[model samples]
Target: MCSNYDSVTSPERLRIYFGVDAPAGSIKGEVWPLYQAPFIRRHPHADVGDDAVPPREAMAGLFGMLPHWAGEVAFGRRTYNARSETVAEKPSYRDAWRNGQHCVIPVEHIYEPDWRSGVAVPTRIQRKDGKPMGIAGLWASNRKATGEEVLSFTMLTINADDHGLFKNFHRPEDEKRMVVILRDDQYDEWLDAPADRSMAFMQQYPAQLLMATPEPQRGRRRTGASPTSK
Candidate 1:
């Protein structure tokens, strides 16, 4: 599960890469559960018969998803990563999944644990080509008692038991998993896909296209260990 990640911070990057305009310094650099970050979705006007507006729009949202029944935003911590296999059946995610609330979470990199050496070492994983990844996700909106609207999202993850690179993370006894990183060309299709066809885009990203390195924790010294790529 991706509980932490680095979000794309530059508005120009968002406009050039994701084709959406966002104000500078609007998104946080690092994102954790409940942290506000930008996500891309099909513009509401597009579905309402507006032809002049852009098809896609970017908005700041909490990293974790909050269902309509959630009493507080803090519930996002456990809903940050929705398993692709059960998302449609899970109560917390079913509504968004059923409503075709598909979205893309722009990530600079994601952090996972490298338990290869018996100790859990923090590892940073990113595309080998150094491009921002648009991970497949679902977004939802909830209203607070004060009538304020809160938007949130969750990354969709798939089983990676046999994946070349991701199978090496986590512990030996745990079920391996990785986020569904969509190809650049699939961005529009993902947002427009129906629930029945969304699963087709949940395939794992190629191991050859990704690289991982040990990222020392705050105040920790850098290690001489070599980075890993399949």
Candidate 2:
């Protein structure tokens, strides 16, 4: 599962790659669960079968998904990633998957663990070409009692037990998996396709295009919050 990733691509970069309007806010660097990050999705009109308007745009959405029935954002902690094999059956993602709430999460790289040394060491994985990756994802929006709308999303992942690089990360006992990174040519079709056809875009990216290196975890920065508050 991809819980943490680098989202340092500037808004200008997104505009160029995705051919969509840039989000207003600055792009996040280290995007952790629950943090707001930019995601590319079909324009609202497209969802309603109106093709006269623009096709897609970029919006800031929370990293984790919040089912409409969920009372608070805390429920998102466990919904940050939805397994591709069962996303259509899982309560948290079934509706979105069926309703065609697909999105593309842009990231510079993703973090994983390397256990070859007998210990789990954090590793940074990115495309060998140094280009940003567009990970397939599902999104949902819920209105709060206070009349506020919350936009959230979850990255889709598939079993990577046979993947040359992905299978080396995480625990050996745990089912190996990796987020589905979409090819540049597949982005438009992925966002415009219907729910049933979305599954066809879940194939693993070629292992030859990826590279990984051990990266020591950085020290936590000090915050001004009091110890009691923390």
Candidate 3:
């Protein structure tokens, strides 16, 4: 359900934050819903002098599934998130769950919403402490009709126990529950955890460290909002 996120993080910052050292200027955008970057994993060795982390080779993109994935390929509707709880039973994810694929999805922040007015008012979700947060994710390589190869991912979800970060997602029509929040020390385990332990890492939530900001609405008029002729 994490369809939008800020993919414009700096490579140095991303390296320090994710330890994979994405190539410079490789950050996607502020509201990314897909991974069509020509250089997806360009900087597999991004480094900012943080403690020794895992090698870039441990990272995997969605494309890894192609040239072999026999399932129907459709991304217009299929997304990245696979709830850890039922992954073992779901047709779209069960196979991947048991194999323990390694992946690292870098994100700066995400957009959630409040649909009280029957219209969604976007609320930007980030660390309450102003630090970036990484949501545990799974990626798959897909082939587009345009004949271009791409990678995409999804963020897992869970109930909002007390974070109040997304009570709006639980609305009657929403009924959304699942989330993917991880700690720095838990990254390795999350990226490589077995199906049994994946749940433990996916359920962290880390609400105490998260903060939400309502983005400002932009003026719609071509020139600008103006006083009516009196």
Candidate 4:
């Protein structure tokens, strides 16, 4: 359900956190901060597995099915988040859930709306410690009979904590949910664990590390009921 996120951490910040040097040798913050819903980011080969083509490149086609895509012709309105609890049962996410289609959503923060008389009041969520959050994600590869590959991703959802709902920003009255957040120690398990074990790893995330607040959010709403947090 967590669709909005901030990936706009500066390259220098990433290098310091990672403690690794980049070849560019210089860095600065990106303009137009990385706030985005990130629906179907990078698109579909990412789910099935990578054998020949690079994984990131393999995912473009899958985004075609998402509602927010902005290609020459994009679906743009249908790109929605998937839920972690019931993903295995939904037709749109079943295959990825059962087949171990996993990924990581890296972000500096996420935006949620607090409903003030039906108006979505945007709020920002971030790691309690000021580090980046690595959110749980699902990926898939869409292949046709023609032998083309497409990759895509969707965030998983969970029930919202009291702080995550009423106290969180952009609180929509109709929805009470949030996304599954992974701990730094659980990143590898999330990305590489088998289907059953992966689910277990998901539960290990601590509640204390999760945090939220009111912050500016990006994206224009077209129409629909309040959406579940990714």
Q: Pick the candidate with the highest TM-score.
A: 1
Provide the overall lDDT of each model, using Cα atoms, as 2-decimal numbers: 0.84, 0.82, 0.51, 0.50
Worst 10 contiguous positions by lDDT, candidate 3: 221-230
Worst lDDT window (10 residues) for model 2? 221-230
Q: What is candidate 2's lDDT per residue for 1-230, written digit by digit as tens?
A: 88778874586778777877767665577877777888889887856766666678888888888877777886677788888888888898999999989999888889887787788788899999978899999898977522578888989998899999999998778788899999999888888778889889889999999999888774232331111100
Model 3 CA deviation exceeding 4 Å by range: 23-27, 37-54, 57-76, 142-150, 161-163, 170-172, 216-230
Stretches of candidate 2 off by over 4 Å are: 46-53, 145-147, 219-230
User: Model 4 — TM-score against the truth?
Assistant: 0.63
Candidate 1 off by > 4 Å: 23-26, 48-51, 218-230
| lDDT score at residue 203, model 2, on the 0-100 scale | 93
10 residues in a row with least lDDT, candidate 4:
26-35
Question: All candidates' TM-scores?
Answer: 0.91, 0.89, 0.71, 0.63
Better of 1 and 3 by lDDT: 1
Candidate 1 structure quality by residue, lDDT tens digits, 95-118: 899989999988999988889999
The local distance difference test score of model 2 is: 0.82
Best by lDDT: 1
Report the alpha-carbon TM-score of model 1 versus the true structure: 0.91
Put down candidate 4 lDDT per residue, 36-153, tens digits, no spaces. Answer: 2222122245466655532332112222123222231222123346656666676666666677767665557766676765677666767779887666777655444224443446
